[model samples]
Target: MTKATLQRRPLVKQILANADDNLLVIGGLGSSNWDITEAGDRPLNMPMWGGMGAPVGMGLGLALAQPSRRVLVITGDGDMLMSLGSLATVATQQPDNLAICVLDNEKFGETGNQATHTSPRNNGPTDSGAGTDLAMVARGCGIADTGTVREASQVAQLVKDLRAAKGPIFRLVKVMVEKLEFVMPPQDGAHLKDRFRQALLGHP
Candidate 1:
C-alpha cells in the first residue's frame, strides 16, 4: 500500500502547540531536534545535540522520575533502529507517562540522507532491502498501544495519544522526505540541562 504524504514541520507544530506546560519533550538528534526547535523552544524541551539513540532511554528515566508529568520522546527511524533493545526495556519498566513518536522519513537525515532499515527496497538509491515496520516491533516488544500514523487527519488523535494514552505508547509517523533549513535550540548541553531541570524541578 502506498503511504500518505505529510510534512514534518506542520505536524510537529500542531502537536507541540497543544502540549501543556507539564509535557516534557525530548527530541533526538538531527532533524528531530530541529523539528522541535521549529515548533518553538521551551525550557521543558530537551533537544539532544549529540545522543544518537539515547532519547527513548532518557525519556523513560524522566518519566519514571516524574510520575506526575508526561514525557514525550520524538526521534527518527535511524535513531530508534540503532537502539531497538531500548523498546523492550521501556516495556519492562512500563512507565505510564511515557510516549514515543518516531518521525520515520526512512532516511538518516543528518548523514547525507542514507536510507535506514525502514526505507522500502528499490524505492530509490538509498532504499533498504527490507522496510521495517517499527510499530510492529514495538508491539512485539510488549507495548500494546502502538500505531503508525500516515495521514494528516490522524494528527489530532496522535497528539492526544502522546499526552493522555495509557503508555508507554509508540507511534511511527511517516513524514515526507524534504530538505529543510535547520532550526536549532541552545547548543550547550549544560545550559539545556539546567533549563530543563529548573523548569521541572525549580532548581538549576
Candidate 2:
C-alpha cells in the first residue's frame, strides 16, 4: 500500500481557507461531506448525504450553468471510481470553470474501510497487479490539467490550481487514513438545495 502522509481535515481547511462568493463547492458522500463541513459549511456548500457517484456530474452541471463561478467537487476515491465515466463526460463538455479533487485514502472509508480499487494490489499469484491512477485516467479522458499530490509542499500550488487555474482540472490527493470525528452539515437535502440555490441565484 502507498504511504499517504497528509491528513484530510487540515488539507480541506487549506483548500477553502480563502474561499469567496464565486466559489461553489460540492462535497461527495461520506468523509468528503464531513471534510467540507468541517472546513466551514456555507450556503454555497452543497454536501451530498447519500449520492455515491453524483458529485462530479452535479459540479459539471453547476459549472455549465454558472460559467462565471468556480465549481469544485471534492470527493473520495471510492466515489470517484464509481463515476469514472463522468470524467470522460466532463472532458467532452470541457467546462473551463469546473475542477475535481479526489481525496484518495486507498480505502473505502464509508464502507467498513475496505481496500478500494485505488489501493495497489498485493500482486499475489492470482492478482491482476493493476493499479488505479485517477489523474492519469483524467489525462486519458483528454483533461490536460491534472495532477496527483502526495506531499504537503505541493499543496500551495494545488490550492492555486484548484481556486484559479483554467479548468476542467483534476487532482488526486493522497491522504492518510485516520479516524476523525464527523462534522456534518444540516441533514435536510431540500434545505441544502434551496440554500445553495438561494446563495447562488438569490432565489430558491
Query: lDDT for each of the candidates?
Result: 0.92, 0.94
Top-TM-score candidate index: 2
After TM-score superposition, the amount by which residue 96's alpha carbon in candidate 2 deviates from its true location, in angstroms, is 0.8
Tens digits of lDDT, candidate 1, 48-141: 9889989999999999999999999999999999999999999999999999999999899988998898887877576655688999999999
lDDT of 2 by residue, 123-168 (tens): 6566866568999999999899999999999999999999989999
Cα error, residue 107 of model 2, in Å, equals: 0.8
TM-score versus the correct structure, for each prediction: 0.94, 0.96
Candidate 2 residue-wise lDDT at 101: 95
Output the lDDT of residue 95, model 1: 96
- Report the alpha-carbon TM-score of model 2 versus the true structure: 0.96
Candidate 1, residue 52: Cα displacement in angstroms equals 0.4
What is the Cα root-mean-square deviation between model 2 and the actual structure?
1.3
Error of 1 at 44 (Å): 0.4
In angstroms, how far off is 83's CA in candidate 1?
Answer: 0.8
